[model samples]
Structure formats: structure tokens, C-alpha cells
Target: MAPSNRPIRIAGCSGSASDRRHAMAMLAANCAHDPIDVIIGDWMSEGNMTGRAALKAEAMPAYEPTFLKSLEPALLDIAKHKIKVAVNAGASDTQLLHSVVVKMVRSKNLHLSVAWISGDEVLPAILDAKARKESPFENICTGEVLEEWKFEPLYAQAYLGGLGIAAAFARGADIVICGRVSDASPVIGAAYWWHRWQRSDLDFLANAFVAGHLIECSSYVCGGNFTGFKALESKGWEDIGYPIAEISASGAVVITKNKGSGGEVSVHTCTSQLLYEIQGPWYFNSDVTAILDDVHFEQLSVNRVALRGVRSGLPPLTTKVGITAKGGYQAEMHWFLTGLDILPKARMLQSQILTLLAPHRSRFTKLTFTLNGTAAENATDQPAATVDFRVFAQAPCEEDLSPKRFFRPCFDVIMQGYPGATPHLDYRLGMPKAFYEYYVTLLPQAAVEHRLHSGDGRSLKVDPPRETRVWPRQQPSCAVTENGVRLGGFGRTVKGPLGWVVHARSGDKGSDANVGFWVRFRDEWDWLRTLLSVEAVKGLLGEEYNGKDIDRFELPKANAVHFLLHDHLDRGVSSTSSYDFLGKNVAEFLRSRHVDLPIKLLNRGKI
Candidate 1:
């Protein structure tokens, strides 16, 4: 098929593997009025890959079985429309998923050609590199040496480019299944194939990349996780629709949701997703590096936002690789302190717990006492007066957290604790559970064994991009000046939640947390840009700031300030003991902080 100038419509069906199964059917059912050229689904995540590895270890299918179930409702519509499908639900076993899907398609009497891309599994490659005394597995976030990781790496999956996916579509594939392609690869691949874009189409590729990122989270751009949920209260979120992207030949994309579906697709919703989990203003992909600092959004119509001015550069030579290993066992115990002296009761209990763990403390890799919640003065309800004091312990051996050693100490301390100390009383919730630790590092895109199994018996290799660029890994330093406005002289101040004036979105990247704050009005951006500094953020973080390194990036075009806090999640959600495991609460926490906002900007109404 030759490239066409007409816009290609791609509907985002799934965000993560567990996303609702209705989107695939929703788009297909509404196709007549809202004709879409392709359907894009994303099913891969950093933590899910490790779980898939464990399944492989058990001699079970590593692919997400839920994805297979998801295809059933859309099968007939897919055949009727001849819609091209692409997804990364193959996880650790692309071939197995391919066989299963092919079997399903044949049983349904449909002649849809399915392709599965491989070579995302790079554990053997990492081992071979280690044997050659090469260090390709250094921790990307902390710069820790491989020797320091200690745990044996069971599996490593490198993020592959979209070329393999694009090639699959080129080879008459009705569906493309991928193992560990970047999350945006499906949309980028489908766009590349639809547009017949070459490796040199950097600008087009980058544009598709951002569009994919925005809608890949499905309903997120349709008010799923929007900060302005109050506005969506009347819209009924029970069935918030999934997102869609209409990409033009020039690479500009218009983001919208399923036709007549609930929820929304406003500029704020689009920008909220645009800032999600991104490392910096420059987004790195195996095929292209997107310069997002210049990107802007324009609301074309209700529930329709156009992403514009996303320039591009050469492809990055390196892509992210996730190495998974046994992180050991972790357990937690919680106690409630109600009524008076919450902090004093928490301290007393902490001191007692430390005494109990003093003998076996060295056995634990991590020992933490976290006090959650605060008592309101003259509280009206019992729950309002209560605060939780949690003690978390992690060790290489599960036995270290056994009832006699860990829980017994916890139980014994209850009698000697504060006057109102009471256990949280959930045994299983506090029991030791095994988890995997993820080690991330950048590997050469050329090193990824990109392969395309085009529904034929042969598996063909997809070569690396012909042109690549070596961009600096470091983010540009923050500047105090923004629209030539100084921080102090802007306007009158008020002590209120920063959220009163700012909208924020946050997510996890490896072991770090990234939070993005943006303003509603153009003039507010000037004040926001000047008011928010690394120091200001540190103050806002308060107790959550554990003195870890933070990287700040200014996105003038998006009217956003992005902050990346290193080692914030204690090795990401897979093994973290954090209350907000995914870092989704980071933005909310920051927004809730009391700050001196300019009354001038605050009077414009909250974002």
C-alpha cells in the first residue's frame, strides 16, 4: 500500500494489560459514525514484565492471557473493517501468544494474519556481556555498579523500536504482537506503516510518538486520571471512554475520545498525559528523540485537542533495558494512634519497635517506620482522630519476617505502646511477600535483537536505524527567569493549597518519581515558572523529600514544571513499601501543600 495524505485514525484500546476490555468493542461498534483506520492497544509495563518472567520460569505462558480474552468481542468487527491491530501484550513470550491468537482466529474462520516480534528478551545477552567482562547493566538511575546489585538477574528485556512493528504491518499483517517494544511503539509503528514513513522521517515519527504517549493510557486523556475530575462528575465516570488520535501526514495529531462516550478530551486532559512519566523536555525513543519543550496544545472543539509544534531530532542510539531479579521478602505491621498526642504515640511505638528489632536489624535490607495521616483538632469522628504508624521490614530470607521474630515483636509491643495503641489487625496484609527488583540501564539500540515473525515460518531481523544521535543524558539546568518576571515582585500572596492554582500529574520511572505541575492561564505560567524552583519543590515535598537527588526541567510550551526525584519509590512499585506505590499521588501531595500563591493569579479561578 502506498502512503496517503489522508489522516489516519488510531483508537487506543488498552493502556495497561489490565485496562477494561470494552474499548476494543466500543471503537468497533461505533465505527460507522467514527471510522478509524487502525486500533492501537498497549499492554506492557515495567513491573508486569518481571511477573511474566516468573510465569516463564514456571513453564507457563508469559503473555498476558487477559489480552487474548480481550480480542474476542472485537473479532468480527476487526474482520469486517480490516482494521490493523498492534499491541505489546506478548510480554515475555511473543511466539506462544502468536500461536494462541492464530488458533483463535482460525477457529473463528477469519483469515487475519498475525505477526509477533521477538528478541526483546535480552537476559542471555546480558549474561554473555558479563562473561566478556563488559558492564552493560549498570543502574541507569543511581549509577550503581552491577556488582553492587548483588541479586542474580533472572531476565532482562530491552525496549525495542517501532521498526519491527512497522515491518510487520508492511508484510500484510492484520495484527502485530510485540514483546517489549516501547509503550508508544504500536501507534508509532501503525503510523509509520500507514504513512510509509522512512527511518529518516524524524519529525513525523516524533509527532506520532507523542500522540501515542498521550492516548496509550486510554481513558486518561478522557478524564480517567485528570485532576479536574470535579468537572467530570456530571459526565458519569463509570464508563469513561477511551482516547483516540487522528494523525495527519504532517505528524500533527488531534486527540479525541470514543464517539458519544462519557468523559472528555480537553487540552488539560491531553497535557496531563503529555507530562506523564516523561524524563525531561526531550523524550528519547529508539527511533526518535522528541523535543517537547516547544510542543503546545490547541482545543479545536469540545473533547478534541490538537497537539502542535512538536519538533524532532535524530534517533537516540540507546534505549532502556529492564533487568529483573529476586528482591527478597517484605512485610509490614501497622498500629493506630487515636485522640491525643499522635506524634508522641508514634515516637514511643517507634522506639519500642527499634528495641525489638535491634538484635535482628542487620538481617533486614530495609527497615522503616512511617507515620501516616494527621489528627484534626477537636475531631468529630473516631476515624478522623486516628493515625497509622506502620513498621515495614524487608530481608533476603522470608523466614526473617516469620511470626515469631517479626510479628511477635510487633504483637508484644502493642501492650507496651501508647495509651490508645491498637493494631491495624490485618494478618495477610502484613505477611511477608516476595517481589522482584528492577534494574534499568540504557543499551545500544543496535544491540537489541529486533525480529519480525510475519505470520510466516521465518523470523526476519529488523535492522537498526541508519542514522542515530548521541544526546546528553543530563537535563538542562533550571533558570530563575521566565518571561522576564522575578519571583517576589509579581503580586499579592495567599496561604492556600498550591493545587488551588495549579494542575499536576505524576508517575513512576524505574526507582524515581516524576511530577509535572501546570497552570491554566497563559499569564499564570509566568508566575508559576518563576515561583516553582527546586528549592521551592523541596519545601513543598516536606516529609516526603528524603534528600534524594532531584532533576528539574522547564517546559515553557506546556506551561509545566517537571521534577524527577531519584530513589523516591525505593526501587519502583514492584518492591516499594510506599503508600503511593505508583507515584500517582506525588502530584496530588505537591498540589495539596500550602503555598503563597499570588492573589492576582489565584483570582482567575482554580485550574
Candidate 2:
């Protein structure tokens, strides 16, 4: 299905900065491409949510000060273009968002229908169910029952999906406000409305999923956090290009930036983003499955990637839950120490430092000690020599003698306190810092669900919505068995003939692994068996390695061979044992065995 009018062109603004202003600016800048249907903006973060809650308590829009004020001119542009706007700028308060939007529409004399898509924030909803003595929603963060604890939420956003946006559109809303929706949700919603894609058309949904992944974070694929940002800046940062998505009915998405805009999109930039900040083989989505291996990016232009071969399979069985828990108290005290045996002296200082707080030590829930540029604790045969140190202590509860009081007192150690006790305390004062503790709980996707409603002119309402849950099964395991198949680390094995090298690489985070590889088309598995085998695969691993130590595998659902290797622990490259080095050996072995055929590696299965 094509758009009733022109393809219902839309623009998305990244959430990190002045989301509303940028979204408006993009629309205004591209005014020449008139009759744009929707403009989406995002401005939600943990901190932003908390800040917005505080503003609502004072009867203000949370984004009023920063976004609303900054985007006044842009909001005017919406009136001029009659462009529908969607944003999470309301943060924790959708009602407040609706009120603000209505007021702005009226003030601008724009005849725009406004709607606030709510119901994702299940904190209050779950709490209400709990008060009713029924099972409040189970924790999505962890599959366990909801723990009995006080929850002060500035925002409890449910990662809503396309259905929510469709309902907003159905309600004749020109503007929609959302809380925490998946970055892809807005794109999905827009595509769902424009193309009228069926819910069962999981393939198109998957295509939309890829499109959202590409452009959801805005400048990311357009050189914002590009690894080759240095080389791209010469093109011009003054007019940094924004990402664009050209989606078709077949669920194919071609990603490109606005023409003439700054920035370049290449294999490096696109591939870098493909694996950014991802944790597991399955890139979790609210509704559809986006098998990363099925997605391919071909450089169509300087800043374009022809994204094809994305096919949706059976949807995942679970939905992810986001839970935040209060952890403990953390205190950091930084000091400039100068002494003969400064390293040894720092060790002594930490002991002395702990002794000073012994009185209130009982109030602590947990204790940790750390130092910068020196070990906070040491073991030795003889009494430790003098050394300088900076120490930090953490506990479960920081309320009593914590952030405000206890941690700050450590700053005086060098002056009046430590000087009075030891002559070796000749060092500068330390900067005292206090930190709050936060813990995360992973609940099964089934634990948290949202209701969907069809608005009846007043407000669309859905209750006891479909259950959304994420199952936390152990990752799958891998094993290699053959006489001639050889493998080794990247360093040991330089070249291989028959074997394909699976190189381990780091994502831009420089912390997590974002490994991907192409699979030969001849490889096959029963789709039905693959669907049922993800959980069963673990059982297979358990049986094989009973009583042994192997943590987890990344077999989300397996039709093809899957492997994961932590980049840090691997020998230069994260690949199956010696299989990497056996490339040449395997080629020879297979040829000798009389199994011959032309073979090639691909980035994705097929486009």
C-alpha cells in the first residue's frame, strides 16, 4: 500500500539535545519539500524524566524551561506547515503534554488535533493493582515477583510500539505525545499509518524496525558519533545532514541523509551503528523480531546505505521490562597526597580514614574502598610504609551520614584531622563527592504489559492490555567436532582457505562486543525447529557440559550456526576455538574429502 498522498514524508529529531527545536528546524529547513505529514521529537532521559516530574509538581511542563522556550519559533512553524508533531518532550507527564499542546495550538491559531498517547507508565497502574490485592504486573526487569518497596517514580514509561501511534492517528490527532517508546516506534507508527501495513506483515514491520534503528538516534549514522568524524568534518558541520529512510512495501528500507546536508554515510559509519550498544544477538523490540544477520547495508551513495534483505520471522515470545531500584550509598573522597612512601602512605591513610568514621560505620549497609592512581588496600609481610591515597566508600543506604554529611567530612583529613594524628599527613585537601546507588532488576517480558484502546473522541483507552514479557533464558552454546577442521586465534592463524574468519570487534562504546558475520546460503534449518529450539538449545548445552562451567550462549533462535566471543577475553579475535585459524586447513581438508563448490561470505544472508 502506498501513501494516499505523496509518501507522507516525515522527519525525526534525536533525543539527546534540543529535540523539539531540532525537529522544528529540520521541518523549517526542508520547507521546500512541503506538505510533510509528521514531525517527531524526543527529549527523554532518566535525568530528564526526574526533572520533568519535579516541574509537574509545580504545575509546569517538565520541558517548559529548556524545550518549550527554545522551540517557540519551531512550534510556530508547525502552525505554518500544518505539520503534526509527536514528542516525548513531555517526559513523565502526557496529560501535561496534551494541555500544553492544546494551549500552543490555540495560541498559534492552528487547527491541529492533539492527542496524548498514554498507558505505558505502569508504575501507578501496577501499584493500583497491588493496592487492590491482585497481582500487580510482574517485574519485567526480572521475572521475579515485584518486591515490596517504596517506588518514587518521576517517569515509568512503557516502551510502546506502533499500535499506540496508530490509535493516536485514528483519534484524528495532529500531534501525539508519548513517554518512553522504542526509538523505532515513531518510525513504525508513521510507516504503519502511511503504508497501512498489516500487523501480520511482520516482514514490513521488520523493515520499519531496521529503518528506526538507522535513524532513531538522528545524527548517529550521519557522522555525529561516527568513528571517521574527523574525515567527515571537512564536508561541513555547519549543516550536518540528518538521516532519512526510504521504506517500500516489501519492507526494504534505504537509508540516506538529506541531499546537500553535511556528513557522509559509508560502510564504516553504517556498520558501526549496526552494532552500537547492543547486548545480545537479539536486538529486543516491543513487537517484531529484527534478526541482525538478516539485515544488510550497501553503500548506495556518499551518505546512503541500501538496507535490504530484512525479513521478519516469528515475533519474539517476550517483551523487555525496565526497572530501577535504589541500590546503596557511595562516597568518593579525592586527595592530593605528598609523602616519602606515598603509595604505602595512602594505604595507611585509608585505615586511618576508616577509623575516623568508625562511629557511624554501623549505619552503613555496604562498604567498598577504592583509590585513584594507587591501590587502596595492600598486603605485605612487614608493616606498610607511608603512601598517599584517595579513597571511596559505598553502602546500601546513604541517607544517614551520607551524601550531605558523612562523605563531605573526609575533605578535612589533610588539614585539622589527619595532621593532628600523624606527621606523615603532609598532603593537600581532598575533594569529597557523594554518589547515589541504583540497581536494575530484569523481569520477564510477560510481567509487564500495556492495554491498547480506540479513542471515542474524548480519550482513547485500553485496559488489561496484551501481556508483554521477555523471557531470560541462558544463551546457547557452541561446539566444534571434526577431524580436519582447524581453528586458532587471529594472531596465530594469519590466513585460512576453507574456513571463514569471524573477527571479534568492539562497538563504539569500547566496552561491549558487536560481532556479526555472514552465513553461507546453503546452510539450512527447519524454521519450526529453530523457533522451538532456542530454549531447548540450552538444555542441549546443559546435557553436554553437565557439572562444567560455561555461562551462556547467544542463540536467541537458531536456524543458522551462531557463535559469540567476548572481544576482551578472546585471543585478538572472538571466534570459535581454533576454527578461525583452520581456514586454510579446512579448505584443504574439504577438498581432499572431495566436497567441492564455489563459496563466498556475505554481510547478510541475502537482500
Give residue 238's lDDT in candidate 1 (0 to 100). Answer: 72
Candidate 2: tens digits of C-alpha lDDT, residues 1-607: 1246344555656644444345566655566663355666556544344345455545765553445653556766665666656666656666665677678768988676767666555555545655775654443222235545444433344566666676677566667777666667777777777777766777788778777777766666776654345666688865666677766666667777666778777655565455444444455566676655544566776666777566665545544333333333444455554324554555666666677777767776544444334323453422232333445444544465453445544544555434323332322222222332111223223444543322234654432224333434443343421221222211132223222312111231111123322222323222212322223323432322223222222321222233232222211111112222212122123212211112233222211
Best by TM-score: 1
Which runs of model 1 end up more than 4 angstroms from their true locations?
Answer: 1-4, 482-484
Cα lDDT tens digits for candidate 1, 357-381:
7778888999888888898889999
How large is the C-alpha RMSD of every model relative to the true structure? 1.8, 11.3
Per-prediction backbone clash count: 0, 42
| Candidate 2 error regions (>4 Å) | 5-8, 17-23, 33-37, 46-65, 124-145, 148-155, 237-240, 314-318, 324-331, 336-349, 366-399, 402-405, 415-457, 462-472, 475-607
Assess each prediction's global lDDT (C-alpha) against the native.
0.85, 0.49
Q: In model 2, what lDDT does residue 257 have?
A: 67
What is the alpha-carbon lDDT for the whole of candidate 1?
Answer: 0.85
